[model samples]
Target: METFSSIECFVRSAEVGSFAEAARRLSLTPAAVGKSVAKLEARLGVRLFQRSTRSLTLTEAGQLFLREVGSSFNTIQNAVANLASAGGQPAGTLKVSMGTAFGRLFVVPLLGEFLRRYPAINPDWHFDNRQVDLIGQGFDAAIGGGFELPQGVVARKLTVAHRVLVASEGYLQNHAAITEPQDLAHHQGILIRSPQTGRVRSWQLTNRNREHSPLMLKARMTMSDSEADCAAAAQGLGIGLVSMPIAIPFLESGGLQRVLPDWYVDDGNISIYYAEHKLLPGKTRAFVDFIIEQFAEQGLAQRFSAV
Candidate 1:
C-alpha cells in the first residue's frame, strides 16, 4: 500500500513537473509528496528527478520508469475507483472546466437540480475560454469544443458549434436588408479575434445546399469573447457572427435577431471531455449523463444546427 502511494506520488509529480502542484492534486503537503518520492527513489535505487530551485526535470531513468508505469498506475487507480464506486455513493469534489458564458447560461442553470439528485457531490467548476489539461490539472471533466484529446481522454459531444449572423432589429432596420452573403459587405460587422491565434477569425458561411459564401463585412468592432460579440450585436453596433450556445439568450429575448438564418459557419462540436476509464468516477459519470440528458431533452443539437 505504501509502495503504491509512493508510485502514485512519483507519477503525479512527473505529470505536472512540480511536487507542490502534484501535492495540491493529491491533497497532500509538498513535503509529504517529496518524502514519498524520496522513499520510492530509495526503494528503487534510482534518482527520478533533478532537484532545482525553479524547475523540476525528470532524469533519464525517471522518464523511462514513468513511461513504463504511468498508464499501468492509472489503470490500477481506475480499478480501485471502480470497486469503491460499486459500493459507495457518488461523493467528492467534481472539478470541471468550461467556457465562461456557456457554463453560466447553460450548465449553471442545471446545478440546483443536479445537486438535489446527488447531494453528496460538490461542484468545483472553472470557467475560461481555453483548453485545459484534464489529467495534469486534475480536472474531472471539461466542456467545450476543439480539444486535442490526450492519451487517456475521451469526448462526448453535446451540440454542434455552429455560428450564425446576428444583429439587433434596430441595426437591421437602419442598414440595408442583408438577403444574401454578398449584401453583408455593405453592413458593419462585429468580429471575434481568435484567442489561440491572436488574429481575427475568418470563415465561410455554408448552407443546406452546400453552397459556400465568404464572410465579408466592414469590421466595426473586434473582440476576443463570443459573449462580447453577442452583446455588441445586441446593442446595435453591428452584425456579429456568434456561436449558437452564446447567442441563444439574446435571440430568445428578442434583443438580437438572426440575419441570413439559413447560412452558418460550422466550427465543430461542443463536447464534454473526460478521462477514458471504463469504471469512471461516479461523480463524473453522473454529471456527464445529466448534461447529456438535459441537452437531449432540450433538443439542443437540432436547435443549434443551421441547416
Candidate 2:
C-alpha cells in the first residue's frame, strides 16, 4: 500500500515541475521532497521521475501512475475538506491570487474582519496583474475580472464592474470637444493590456437601451497597471477606460469625469474561481463566504451574492 504522505508529495512535485517548489509549498526541504519520492519509488519498485540537475521529468511508469493516482489524491483532499467544512470550525491556511487593483481596494481591507470572525484561519494572498495557473501554483482560489476562465476551473460570481471612459477635466477642456465614441480616435488614449490574453483591451460600450459595441481607441500610451492608468487620466495625461470601482473615487473627487454617461460597458462580474473538486478546505470555504458577505455589505452584493 502507498502512503498518503508520499503520494501527496509526489503530486505536488509533479504539478510544480520541481522538488524545490513542492518543498516550499509543503513547508519542507528539497532533500525531504527528494527522500519522499525515493521512498515512494522504492515501495512501488519502479522509477517515477527522471531526475536531472536542471529538470524533473516523469518516467513512463511514473506518468501512468500519476494519471491513475492524481484523481485519487484529489478525492482524498476533497474528502478531508468535506469533513472540515462539516465540522463548522473552519481553520487552515487559504492561498488566494488576485489582481493588484481589486485586491488593494476591496479584498485586503476586509481581511481583518474575516480574521476577526475566524481567528483560526490564516490567509496567504498574492496580488499581480498576471493570470496565474492556480493548480500549478498551488493557490486555493483566484479572484478575476471578466467572464472567461480556464477550462476545468469552477468560478463563482463576486461583483459586477462597468468599464467607463474617463478623463481629467483639464484634458477634456484642452482637447477637441467630445460627443461620440468616434471622438476617442482623435485624442490620446491610455490602453491597458489584458493580463490573461496578452492583448490590448477595448472599451465595450452600450447605449441607453443597452445596444453595445466595442469602442476602439488609438493608444498613445500603454500601461499594465489599472491604478496607474487611472492616475495618468487624473493627471490629464490621456483618456482611459477603467473599471467603475477603481474610477469611483476619482469621479467623486472631480479628478476624473465620465465621458459617455448614456453609454455603459459591462466588464462582467468579478468571480472567485477554484479547481472543480469535491473537497475544498475549511479555510477556502470560509474566505469565499466572507468575501461574498463583504461585497454584499459594500453594495457590490449583486455581483457575488449568489455564491
Candidate 3:
C-alpha cells in the first residue's frame, strides 16, 4: 500500500536522522525518500521534520508519531516480507522485558523449545522487576505484571497476579496465632515497597465473602522485589504479602505455608505487552502466542492464584 510505504519512509527517516541514510537503508534514492516524507507530511498536514541546509531533526509531532508508530513499522515489514518468503519463520532480534523470577520460572525454561522452532530468531531478554519504556527504549515486547500502557501499546494477560500472606512454620509457631486479618499487626511484617514509586504500599485484603478488610501492617523488613519478600518470609523474618507465582514452589515444598489462607490481595493480571498495529511480525506474534499457550498448558492461572 502507498500509505504503508509513506509511513515506512517517515519512520526510517526519523530513526536514521537523515533522508539519505534512511534511503540507503530502504534501498531508495534520497530524493525519493524525501518526496515520500513530503507526501506524508502533506497528507497529514503536519510538519514531521525541522529541515535545514546541513541536518534534519524531527518536529514535536514527528517525535510523538515515531514513538507510537516506529516499532510497529518494523513489525509490519517483517510480517509482509515473511509472508512473501518460504515459511513465515520470524527472524531477527526480539528485545523483550520481564520480571526476574517470573521469567525464570515460566519463560526461561521454554526458551529452548522456542529457539528450536525458530532458529532464525535471536532472543534478547531483559529480566528486571521494574517496568521499562517499551517505545522509548526500543524494546520489541515485554512480559510482566500490570504496567501503565503508553499510547499505541496493548496487553494480553497471562494470569491473575494474586497476592497471599505467607510465612514459615517456625515463625508462625513462635508468634501469636493469626486467626484473622486484624491479627497480622501483632507479627513482624516482611513487606514489599513499590518498584515504581519507591513507597511502601498499604492494602485491604479480600475474602471469598467479598469483604475488603484493612491491614495496618508495619514492615520490620522491607524489600522491593517480590521474590525477596517471599525469601524473607521463608527465612522466618515475618509474614509477607507476596504474589503466589513466586511463592508457589516454596509453598509446594513445605518451605512456606499460607498465613490466613482465607484471604488474599488481588494485585492484577500479568500480561504480555507489545505495540498495537494492524500487522505484527511473525517473531513477536510467535512469542506472544507461545507464551500464552504455554501458561495455559501449565495451569499457571490457578497456580498463581490464591483461590
Local accuracy of candidate 2 as per-residue lDDT tens digits, 29-125: 9999999999999999999999999999999999999999998889888767656642477777788999888788878998888878888777889
Winning candidate number (TM-score)? 1
lDDT of 3: 0.86
The lDDT of model 1 is: 0.89
Candidate 3, residues 1-307, lDDT tens digits: the string is 8889999989878877889988886789999999999999999899999999799999999998899887767767766745742365677778899999888988899999998988888899999889997865667799988688889799999888788899999999998999988898788888888888998888889997878899766789889987888888898989998888899888999989999898999888999999786687677888899999988998888788787
Instruction: Give the winner by lDDT: 2 or 3.
Output: 3
Model 3 pairs in collision = none
Worst 10 residues of 1 by lDDT: 78-87
lDDT of each: 0.89, 0.80, 0.86
TM per candidate comes to: 0.93, 0.88, 0.80
Candidate 3 stretches greater than 4 Å from native = 1-87
Relative to the true structure, candidate 2 reaches a TM of: 0.88
In terms of lDDT, the best-performing candidate is 1
